[model samples]
Structure formats: structure tokens, C-alpha cells
Target: MGEQVSKQATIVGMLWTGGTPKAKEVEENMASYFNVLQGFLLYFYGSTVGAGPTLSSNLHQSVMQVVNSSFNLMKDSVSSYGSRSKDQKVAVPVLVGKVWEACSGLKKAPATNIAAIGRAMTQVAVSMKDVLREMRELKPDSGGQEDDQQTSGGVAGDGDGNEDDDDDVGDMGNDLSPEEMKVAELAMEVVSDLLLVIKELIRSITGLLKMEKADTSGSFVDSLEKLLKSSQVIGAQIDELGACLYPPQEVSTMEAALKKISSSLNGIESEVEDLKGSTDTFVKACSGLRGSIKQLELVLSCCSVGQLEEQLTNTSLSH
Candidate 1:
């Protein structure tokens, strides 16, 4: 399967990059390539999967959801064959990469129902952690110009040597006013608190997973699926929040993210009573998240009012 996926990814890259096995020929063979890959997935997801495999139903369904998304992306690429956009050329390779991930993911997918849900939520937490780390790199826009090599972290200079890379993220703390930097710091706090929510949420999931003879019944599996779906919802809203956390903070988007996060948290919390051995840690995390949101909103409102007053004062002086 890996070799097959490698061939597909390589071919797609070649097709878009004008490599061997001309695009027209590969275009004709695209369906066969897709079928070969789809067959592997079907072998796993089909009746053979139920031939006394340790993989739970939840694992099968979760894998299908992501694999289906990869299929849709590939279909779009095929449909736009002759007129691939520049972005599509770049993305087509990546979309193929996701198929590779979906297939490779089977080995990593948890066999136990509760643990499968835990694994899914953990992936979300890892993503949230990445956003939090990047948010740390964000410094208030000093209207500074960076060359191609220099990044938000700092310039690639102070090079001791390639063999012994110093590899320090540039701390430009002195570049911005404390007042300006505080907005980013507050945003970071929100991200930090959200991570706490994920941490607590994962604890609940793993707790349920650890129960002696964990549930495999349909109704229980349905509830777990709902939790995974809610986690995905929270994960998406976090992405939105991360995008808006930069300078000139997007208050409306941030507020909308908060609203959605609250709703998702409510859904997550609803399962607490039903999940055996789960604790109230998520409840406490939710409270902490609310506090962080309120703090960030305070700064946003202060900045908005300050801007309005400055404009009003400028108008009075002009009059």
C-alpha cells in the first residue's frame, strides 16, 4: 500500500511538474491508480475488516471519514485536470500526501473503542499545541521588514556554523510597547487555557478507555462518536481563533470562536455523567477558558474604545 501510495504521490507531482509518464497518459491512468488505492482501503474497511480483527467499529468509521475527505480532494483534482490552477498544482501533491497518511494511519489506529476516541482527541490537542507555539512567535507588527530568509523568529544570522547550529528563536521583546504586546500575551493565555481544556478532555477519554472491559455496545459507541465529532468542531474553531490572534486583533472573529467553543464545551460536558470513571476536570478547564476569554475580550474592548476616542479628539482639534 505504501509503495502504491508513493507511486501515486510521485506521479501526481510529476504530472503537475511536467515529469516523465506524460500528464495525458497519467490522466488516463488516474482512475486505475485511484482504484488500486481505494481497493486497499476497502480491504480494510470492508467485510474482511470484521473477520475477527481487533480494530473496533469506531476505528473503522473514523478512518472512513478522513479517507473519504481525501477521496473528495482527489476527485476535484481529477475534474480540473486540464486547467489546474497554480495553487492546485501545489495542493494536488499535498492532497495525495493526505491519502498516504490515511492509509498509514490504519496501523496507528486504536483497536479499543474508547482509546480510539482518545487517539482522535489527542490529534486535535497536538494541533492546538502547534497553534499555541506559533502564537508565541507572534510579535506585535512593528511595521518591520524581513528579508526572505529572516522570519518572525528572527534573522538566520549569528551563524556559529551549520554543523553546530545555535538554533535560537529571536526574542524581539524590546521592539514593541508593553501595552501593544499585552494583546498578544492575552491571546496566548486564551490558547494556553484552551490547551488545558484539551488536556482535561483527553484525561476523561483515556479514563473511559482504561475502564475494565471498556464498552463496545452500539449506543455507547454512538456517544463516543459524538464526542469525537465535537472535538473536531472545537479543533476548527481553534484554527479560526489562531488566525485572528495576530495584531489588530480580529474581535468579531475571536468572539465567534468563543461562542462556538462554548457550545462545543457544553456538548463535551454533557457526556461527563455517562462516561464511566471520568472526572470533573473538563468542568474546571471550561471555567478557566471562560476567564481567559473574558480577559482577552477586555483588552479588545479597551483597544476599540481607545481608537474611537483618539478619532473623536482628532475631529475636535480639526474643528
Candidate 2:
């Protein structure tokens, strides 16, 4: 599949270099491009026949992403093939570049349904970590020390000369007033707690992956797929929770995100239990995460109440 896509890439790339491909040439190559994708689909489906239950979830999503994105770019490349030289030069090559990317991506797609879902959950963990990193950088209203930050560059590089993730996380204490510091501190704790939740979620995914399922029935795979879907929902709500953490924190929105995350976690626990998978460690992780989430919700509720009281007090003074 990869080799076929590469050849098509070279062949289609030539169309724009010399001149506009003839209409017949465009039509023929368009068909060829499609054939390559079709061949891949056949291979993917054939290889994962045992994983049909997950076909509607991560496995299916991964295959379609490669196929559909490649298809769209290939179609655009063909359209550019029949256009003016200037148009062809500007658009076709970029489309061809993307097609090459899709080709390369084909080799990297997960070979197993478990791996596909694992990748999805790992991606969620990575995103949540990014949010935590960013939130940790949240400064006091008086602000962070810009001069210190300027000088702190290159200070944390490792032996590989690769800068650590903490390179971006500036000094935690500079000129923070009490109230602002409290907010920043609590906000950081909330993000940190969320990160732990995703960590536990990934661990649970790992446990499932390590299990040997004697039951390869459709229902068994379906249950696993449901777990993947729940992980995805938790991932999304984590994103929402992160986004709502900015100034004047949207307590309701954050609460809503937390609620969804808690619900999804419950769903995951239920699905795993149905699979008769070992759930003791996972259950404990979920319990700990739920505790953290409750604390965050309580903090948000306090902030909400404080904001309301301040507004009310100001209104009374004005009256």
C-alpha cells in the first residue's frame, strides 16, 4: 500500500512540473490514486477481521482518517492537474506534499485495534499534560518575572541537548499578591489533579491491553470499543476543562466538563467490569481521581459564590 501510494505520488507530481496533464492522463491517475486507497482498505479490513467489533471505534477511525484525508488531497491534486500552470504550481505541489504525508502515515497506523485505542488514550494524556504545563505557568495579576524568564532559557537542557518540558514553566513565585496567588495555586492544583486522572486512565488502558481475552466474541470487542469511546469523551472534557481555566474561570463550564469526565469514568469502570477484566487497581485510580475532581468542583463553587457576593455587595453600595 505504501509503495503504491509513493509511485502515484511521483506520477502525479510529474503532471504539474512539465505542463498540465491531459484530461485523459488526469482521469487515469485519479482512478489510480483511488485504487491505492481501496487496496489499503482491503488490507486493513482483512488484517483486522478479528477486530470487527472495534471497527466502529478507534480502528475504523484510524483507517478512515488515512483513506479520507488522502482521498481529499488526491482529488484536489487531480483538479489542479487540469488547471493553468500557475494554479498547478501553487496548489498541486502542496497537495502532493500532503499526499506524501498520508502515504508515510499509512506505515505508522496501528496494526491492532488495541494499539489504536491505546494511541487514542495516550494522545489524551499528552494533551492533558500540555494543559497542566500551561496552567502551571499562570501568573499572578501583578505578573511573572519577565527578566528572569529571558535569562532562564537554555538552563534546563538535558544531555541530549533537548530542552526539558519545564523550560516553559516559569518561576512560580515572583510578585504575587495573596488573592492572586491563591487563585493561581488552586488553578494549578486543579490542572495537576486532571493530569493524574488521565494518568490513571492510561494505566487502566494498559491493564486492559495486557489481559488475554479468551472471549473473542462480538460482544467482547464491543465492550472494549465502548471503553475507547468513553476515554475519548473524557479526553474531550479535559480539553474543555483546560480551556475554561482562564481568567474569570467559567465555574459552570468547568463543572460541566468535570461532570462529563466523571460520568465517562463511571462508564469506563462499568464497561471494564462487564468484560470481567481485573478492576481493582483501575477502580482505586478512578476513586482517587473522583476525589480530586470533587475538590476542584468545590473550589470552583467557592469561587462562584465569592464572585456573586462581591457583585451583590457592590450593587448594594451603589444603591
Candidate 3:
């Protein structure tokens, strides 16, 4: 059973790495034009309705182009992944971000503009640090340092019980040298940046919904609707990530983090929905104000000079 489990893990790892070669090629393409295109899409979205036929068609085309091109580029590169150099492995996180961005339309989503991409790049860095941490956990003892702690009556084993499982050991590959540790530290910085950007996106969408309510009555309804839908998509992605990172037994911390994000998403969702009724109230208020203004204009227009003067004087005296 142990051997079988190890084999299964091996297979899974192979499957994960299988896409790496193509990942590298597509990422190379992304480095040159993806960021620029992302900028244009963001500008266009900010200026136009994300709901219209033209913008929707363009968005769909851009997404499909990126996805199809990336998949085609990655096809020949999968199986020879591990044999690739360290530099190549290091690029994996960035490539992963690009692929996800394309598939999710996160790049064009108002919540995840170019700024968010910058932040995601930072998370990619922390993810790399996680890679190094795994490596350190697998390091061999130098000299007789910290004599290998063994089970009471069993062969001296690494903390993990899988003795002789070379595949498992390699999966824990690489103790961080001092320099590698620095790289990991840098990666953490990136994760922080990414989180901040995501937060900002949430805030931006919330602000837009607020504005929509204030202007053009319920004209902003469709924008709010799209915002809610986009937010839910993001919430789902975050939940997926939380699940992947946390095992059932150790899920509390991950759950807490996810709950915070979900709460923010729900709050914004509620705010957007409230605008449906609020927009109508604003419209009525504006209509009443217009009537009052027209009445004042007529009263002033029909007033005699002395009567208008007396009226102004009376109004001032009342104040």
C-alpha cells in the first residue's frame, strides 16, 4: 500500500510537471506582449461597457487567442521537465500565473487589471519560496549534525516514513543555500504585493457600484450585475486555492483567510444589490429637486422688481 501511494504521488507530480515545457514557451511569448495587451484591455474596459457586443467579442477573442496559442506552444515541452535546468524550473510560477490569467479572464476583469497582474507576479515569488522550503525539508544531514532522529525500533528514517522512496525524496528536493533563502524571501514580498492588489480590485469594484447608484438612476444596474458575477468568480478561485493548500485536518487557518475574502465579496455583492432600490429612490429625489427648481425659476421670472426684492429680503430675514 505504501509503495502504491508513493507511485500515485509520483504519477501526479509527473502530470503536474508534464505541462512545464510548453509553459516555458508560452511564458516567453507572454513576457513581450501580454502585459501590453493587458494594459489596452484595461483601458478599454474602463472606458466602455463590459456588457456591449463589441467589447465582449473582443474580450472573447483575446482570451481564446492566448489560450490556444499557449497550449500549442507547450505541447512538445512536457515530458522532459525535470531534466531542464534550475532557471527553467524557477520560471514555472510566472507561467502558471499567465495560464491562469488567460483562462480566467482575470487580466481583463476590472478587479484584476495590470496592477493585479503585478501583484500576482509577487505571489509567484512566494510560491517559489515554498518550493525552496520543500527542498530544505529534504536535505541530508551534513557531518553528524543533529543525528538523524529515528523511530523507536525502526531503521533511521527521515521524519517522513517513506524510507527508500527516492521519488518522494526528490519531491522534497533542495535545501536552500543562503542565496536560495534570499530568493525565497523575495518571493514572499511578491505574495504580499499580490494580496494588496487583489484587495484594491475589490475596493475599486465596490466604489464603481456606489457611483453607479448615484448617477443615471438605475442605469448602473447592469454594471453592478456584472461586478457581482465577476466577484463570485474570484471568490470561487480563492476558495479553490484554499482547498488545495489546506488538508482537512489543518484547514482552520486557510478557512479563516478564505472567509475574510468571502466576507468582502459578500459585502460588495450586497451593496450592489441594494442599489436596485436605492437607484429608484435617487431618481425620485432628483425628479422632486427638478420640480422645485422649475417652480423657483417661474416664481422669479414672473416676479415684479419690488416684489422680488421683498421676497428675497423676507427669505434672508427668515434664515
| Best model per TM-score | 2
Q: Report the alpha-carbon TM-score of model 3 versus the true structure.
A: 0.24
For residue 260, model 1's alpha carbon misses the true position, in angstroms, by: 0.6
Q: Could you give candidate 1's per-residue lDDT for residues 227-258 as a string of tens digits?
A: 77888898898888878755445677877887
What tens digits encode model 2's per-residue C-alpha lDDT throughout 1-319? 6667767777877876777667888888888877887897787767666663543355566566667667666767766754655864677677667767766766676665566666766776787778778766666544346545544544653243335436635443333444434544665565565556556555655566534345465565567678778877876876786666565556788778878888887887787777566356656666777777777777667657456557667888999
lDDT of 3 at 154: 35
Error of 2 at 271 (Å): 2.7
| Residue pairs whose backbone atoms clash in candidate 1 | none
C-alpha RMSD (angstroms) for model 1: 13.0
- Tens digits of per-residue lDDT for model 3 on 48-121? 44233323444556555554534432432243354456555544444544444454453453332222323343
Estimated TM-score for each candidate: 0.54, 0.59, 0.24
Q: How accurate is candidate 2 locally (lDDT)?
A: 0.66
Q: What is the lDDT of residue 295 in candidate 1?
A: 85
Root-mean-square deviation of every model:
13.0, 10.4, 26.4
